[model samples]
Target: MSEAARETARFAALAEQSNVGPHTLDQLQADIRRVVTTYPSRPIEPLFHEVRELRDRAFNLLEGRQAPHHTRDLYLAAGLLCGVLANASFDLNRYHEAETQARAAFLCGELAGHNGLRAWLRGLQSLIAYWDGRPRDAVQLAHAGMEFVPENGTAHIRLASISARAWGQLGHRTEALAALRQADEHRERLTPDIEHDDPGGMMSFPLAKQHLYAGTTHLWLRDPTSLTHAKEAANQAIQLYQADPPERRRLGELALARVDLAQVHLATGDLDAAADQGHTVLGLAATRRTESIDKGLDRLARHLNEGPAATSPTAIGLREAITHHRARALPPGETT
Candidate 1:
């Protein structure tokens, strides 16, 4: 080649400046997955800072020039970070903040044209609405998510399961059961494209988690007929969680499942079993605790004042223990 052509080639290769390196992007992606996967097992406070740092890094790069491919990657990573933040906020009982974060994440999904991410974000928003006592809104969000229908993975199934729970809360048995059936159909048709679900962790809806949601849905139906279904589903969820490897065990969800089982036992007038499960949930380390656990325990405490079991020492003791647990927990929406 001519000397001028060689010189031009050398300059061109040397002049490609990037705001972020490929290796940095790779490492950032790895950390995001790690945070996503480990969230159920560890405390959220420390991880909150880690996620913020990672997000800030991505956001700063986003403001600078990058190839189209790198921009998409940065947005995806940033979106996942926002999602984790949303979940953490919801766990802390900051519903408004959580919704804002989910919306931001959804925008990132749009930028990346990632249907999987968009679908999952809708599910997250639905969950927040359900917990915030807006079941009707939750159902609407789930239906909207159905429009995305990811090419692979269980995002749609997650939406259906969430819809089932929301419908149950609204006391629409027909709609709730239909949503449950839809979830089953989605699961049966799922193609396990690891690439579809993106950063998994809590984002991926596994069978065990699905069963837990089913149990909650049945419990919420408030129909005498659903009590048996609730008990069976809750027990099955517990068994599945126990079968997972230690690292993969979602202790928070397991505790929630046990609380559901306990509530079912209460509904059936089985005070002893209820008390047993209640104590087990209360024994969970602080790090593994979630907002749902506290709410479940509160429900148990209220129910304890009704039945013949109300006069029992076990019932009184459980109420006292619940009061103590709530007293010790950091108030929601606050930080240490």
Candidate 2:
């Protein structure tokens, strides 16, 4: 080749190498971790800006990569950003948008040869399906996620818990219990530093989150001991969340756990405790009224109306307060 052509080629190759090198990848990975850590405790709208920017940056970097290793790292970084974007969309109740982002994440995971991220993508999809009122689809997605995550880790545990939740919602008690047991078994096998590639916050399924799921599942099971088990799990989750740093604590999950406690108290005929707990939850920040927490409060309200508390003055007053809180919690343009 001519000297000028060779010089141009060398310059282009150097630029590509510098762009996709380990230092750049590491920085991108750190940025993703920051996004994940910041998401749980804040509103999705602002977080969306950061993740969207990161996704775009990743795409630009990926387009410039030539080597296989560089491509893999860039794909992983891009996949993580897409997953975060999908989660933020789900939080905003934009299920179709979330699915589109999730599909993009799945493609990145596949291209990156990262089964763990792929499994996580499925888990995110399953969560969206569950909130969309498609429990069967959630179950199927969880099963698919499990196939990608063959090891005993947080991702597998999350899939098992998702399965349990779907089964519980379907009123299949035995299946739900079995799935919970499977999750417990997997939890026992997790490595000490399981957060190796998992950036702790939303991506890693910690014990507290697992307990939250267990509590919710047991509430749906509603067997003779289910209520008691549900209360215990919810209490554990609350304790764990309370101990976390402000950034790590998931206020919405904590609120849902409180909802579980309130419902269990109501079921056990402790009207005063139930009412007080419900009042406290209603007084929480409006941002804590995530879809899951809203649904839990609805279930609590329904139970109060349909059960013996239907005519009690205390129950009636509490339920009215809850309704008002929910109305106030609606999205800005949603209030009629």
Candidate 3:
């Protein structure tokens, strides 16, 4: 191009001011980080509304004029906010809404050219599929996430772990174990984000949650050979959860781990240990209840009935307790 044309273009670009300033972008980034870090442990209803408002604000900003870099930043924030909304909908057992939000989030990630957001959105979609009784879909989504490995994030590890659980659910033992091993390998060589502040909570897959995932996968495998592995993993998850501060502990995940531990105990004919785990899960207040946790409790109750202790008073009482516990919330909602 001629120098005259290039000069005009450069001047035009320089004259185009962004609707949002750097401080605005910084504030949006900070808010996104706060939501990402706390959503796993906080009550969902309020966070749901907060995320919705933040996402709407981002969308509105995008509607106005902005520089290319600022537009990308806004898109990234909007994408993450949409992801949190999807997660909240999933926690409330609204699968359709969750998937819809996930799709929007993925689109935002694409617009922003953010591998981390895109990969994490895929994992979130897989999780919704896994819980909504679609193991095949879950596995596919997890694989799709693998296509966009971020430079430094746990999304890839989370994808593999999610796929492992889905494979186990489908009784694909070899595939399940392979996925688990892949996740472990990723973790061993993981390069922490340069600042060591890779968003914690739901965004990053911690070791405790990985162990919990393994326990769940083993339970799905239902193989006698893997029962020992399952028990050990579940115990490790429980210990790790207890080691964290009470505020940081993911209660629903911890409860599900306990329920899986109980299942293993029941399978091994250790009725007392199973009952202890069952009681611990049931102790969680209804306000903190999650759909996954409810299903785990129901699974435990069914396991009780299937075991040799089906006719025993302790088994009967626990089964009845689960029935009542489930009744307390009917299907647990995001709002208390």
By lDDT, the best candidate is: 1
- CA lDDT for candidate 2: 0.83
Segments in model 3 whose C-alpha atoms lie over 4 Å from true places: 1-15, 193-197, 285-287, 330-336
Q: How do the residues 1-336 of candidate 1 rate in per-residue lDDT, one tens digit apiece?
A: 699999999877765767778898989999999998998877766777788788888889899877788999899888988888888878876777888889999999899888888999999999998888899999999999999967567899899999999999999999999999999998887655543465778888888888999999999986777988898899999999999888878988999999999899988989999999999998873657677778878888898888788989999998998999998864444321
TM-scores of the candidates in the order shown? 0.92, 0.89, 0.91
Tens-digit per-residue lDDT, 63-175, candidate 2:
77457788888898899998988877776666778899999999999999888899999999998888788999999999999889633348989899988898888898999
What TM-score does candidate 3 reach?
0.91
Backbone Cα, N, C clashes tallied per candidate: 0, 0, 0
lDDT of 3 at 93: 73
Candidate 1 Cα RMSD after full superposition onto the native fold (Å) = 3.5
Q: Where does candidate 1 stray beyond 4 Å? A: 1-15, 192-196, 331-336
The lDDT of each candidate is: 0.86, 0.83, 0.85
Give the per-residue lDDT of model 3 (tens digit) for 22-114: 889888888888888877677777778888888989999999988888988888888888888888888777888888999999999999998
| Ranking of models by lDDT | 1, 3, 2
